[model samples]
Target: MPAWRRIRSLRVRWLVATLAAMAVALVLAGLFLHSLFQDQVMRQHESALTLQLDQLTARLEFDASGQASIDPATLSDPRWGKPYSGLYWQLDEVGAAPESQGAQRSRSLWDDRLHPEPDSPADGQIHVHQGTGPRGVPLLLVERTVFSAETPARHWRLVVAGDLTEVGDASARFARVLTLSLLALGVLLALAALAQVAVGLAPLRALQRALTDLREGRSQRLQGAFPAEVQPLIDDFNGVLDRNAEVVERARTQAGNLAHALKTPLAVLDQAAAPSVTADPAALAALVHEQVTLARRHIDWHLKRARVAAAQRLPGHRTPLAPVVDGLLRVLARVHDARHLDLGADDMPADWAFAGEEQDLQEMLGNLMDNACLWARTRVHVAAQREGDRLVITVEDDGPGIAPEQRQAVLARGVRLDEATPGSGLGLAIVADLAALYEGSLSLDDAPSGGLRARISLPATR
Candidate 1:
């Protein structure tokens, strides 16, 4: 199989899917958290720069020539006096060229001047921008346009620019920490998922071992209790094993029985072939015929039982009871037409069906109805009804019925109540055996019409 097709393992499938989802979710969560942190940090940086800008505006001094200056000692922050201290302030003409000379600036600016993006801010309105400062360091610039009363005609832009290196460093450190934390969390969650998959599928592993035991003949059936989720499957498999054993046992028994049944005929034939035996040709032929017929009967009986047993295991064997009964009644009516016997079936629903092969049903019902016709004086009645999951069929005849004590004996193989009735004495026995194969029962009861009632209860489909 291809590599993809080989991924039929349920455990592998679940783990891969779970890990993939966790990875995506953790990555997204890390990104969202980092973005939020960056925004808050940027907001705080802007607010600090705005405060410095406000102080610079309030302490500004302009000469009569509209030149602006500030008292360095007046600023409380010591960084304003330190060169390249990352915090700086400068003043510029509103629409001057980038390098306007004599523009007042803080000592922190040193030789480099702040070049903020050109923007016409309304009076007292602050605007923020990103710019570069000394040594190509990134800076966040917060600027405001101011009109001093000392130099109202000459508006100067007051700007405070702070180096963003520290903020970038802080954010980088936070990103690294967040990544490590989320990776750790993902690892823990993955381990948890792995453990859960192992625990959840443990029952399947047990089931596999049980199957191996059964296959190896270490046990007769699957053994051991399982989780509720897997218990039903275990039960069904065990049931199948039991049924298979039953089939094997039945086959063995039937073989032995058939052998035992044929032993007498075979021995008789063996004795007849002896040199010491002296018999006329007609007598010899008659004896051979009788023994051959008896062997054939035993063979047919075992074969019918085997066929029914095999059919019992198969599914979807629905034979409508009404149709089979009708067909059998038609056949038996003609077979016993000389007696002018009343052979008919009681009113049964057309949907009443037997859960077995049609041939098996025919064999069972045919034997019963045929026996009833033989002994019936005036009427042979066949009726069926549904009792829960069972199909109850009763064949009754209005004639001299067998005694209650002889009913069970009559169902035994080759047990005929009346030898004068002219039968192989296997009809009722076959019916009883066939019914038993279907997990059904054959019973003899007193019919309302004062005849022997052969009642059969077989599994039904509808």
Candidate 2:
């Protein structure tokens, strides 16, 4: 049950396989034990028959009448008890009737009808059968044919029987013993299997402890002994940690370079204005404002890049895209309040996600929507939806559409296609940079509203 978590593991599967194989071996061992015990029972039964035969051999003798007879008194013995008293013997001379030997013999011989079947082999060894005896007690019977060495005419068959009840009782007891023993063995094997599973999973528990230590900020890398089978997995995990650290360092370096690269131009543009003219409230303020806005745009672009880098290393609940785009339209409406434009966020699937940092998403959509607000005279529409593995956000307004040749130049850094346009023209360039940072893209196209449509696409993740 503990293994049923989302972090699926192969350890449980391996343990189950080991248990199954052990179970098979135990079953086979029980079978072997049964076979060995059964063979022992058969040998004891044959030994009883051989002992009865040996006694009859000494008792067999010729009387003065020249007839064969057995001394019945010899049948009684201390070692030979109840069921062994069930033995029978028959002796017949040439052309004469048969005579019984034992007092407690089968009543079958009493019938004088007690006759050995001809089907018995001449070699005379133990043969198993079921036949009625004198008392009508069902019997498990053993028979043997015999020959006398002194007289060839003495060809006799010795048939032995024991009560079926005694044999059946003995077998039942043996079976009960075997069953109980096998059951005990199965329980012991099951416990052994459980212990093997625990021993085998010990490494996994150690690995978990190591990872927990890492989460508590105690260790940066896991180093512990593990079975050779898991060595590759540990090595691969270490490699991932190393790569993540490298990516973090590279992101910081690139962020610093971006800040330094854009500051020099803003400095020069500021120095170009004279101090007396810069002191003029209207004209100099406008010049300073434009340059400050350009510098802010560069800063925002790099900041978005840094946020995207951080989010890649640690993903959480997906950032909702519909609300982010909607919020941007509302703020853009407030920014261009004087124009009195009607901005509506088009309905999109609410579950669409951007999968990047929430603030970076806000910056990307805010810049695009603000640009739409700047150019539109009456209406601006923003919407986002998914296509395949990408989520596409499009902002459209009823403004002059970009000429086919000018669309490419509009995305270039510091390339303002329209000089009369009030701003520094870095908005589109910054949007393009942020898009690239998240492995996304931005494109310019004709809008259905008779204006430019800025479409931005970001990779979709669940």
Which candidate wins on TM-score? 1
RMSD, each candidate, Å? 3.1, 11.9
For 1-462, candidate 2 gives per-residue lDDT tens digits of 564652365655665676788778877877787777766776686677667766765666764444455665566653333333455555533234434433234333554223444454454565666665546655545666556555555555556655555666676787788778877887887788778778978899999998998889899888899899988998999899887887778677877867686677567665756464335567666777777776776776667667666565365737888788777777777888899999998787777887777777787788788888878879888877788978898999899878989999989777776688777677888788778877799999999989989999987766
Worst 10 residues of 2 by lDDT: 99-108
Question: How many backbone collisions does model 2 have?
Answer: 1
Give the alpha carbon lDDT tens digit for every residue of 1-462 in model 1: 578765997888999999999999999999999999988999999999998888888898878888777888899999998999999998888877666832788999988888888779998899999989999999999998887676678888888999999999989999999999999999999999999999989888888998899889899988998988888988898898889899999999999999999999999999998999999999999999999999998898889788788879688889888989999988887888889998888899978999999988998899998898889899999888899999999999998999999998999888898889988788888888888899999999898999889999999995
Residue 373, candidate 1: how far off, in angstroms?
1.4
TM-score of each: 0.89, 0.51
The TM-score measured for candidate 1 stands at 0.89
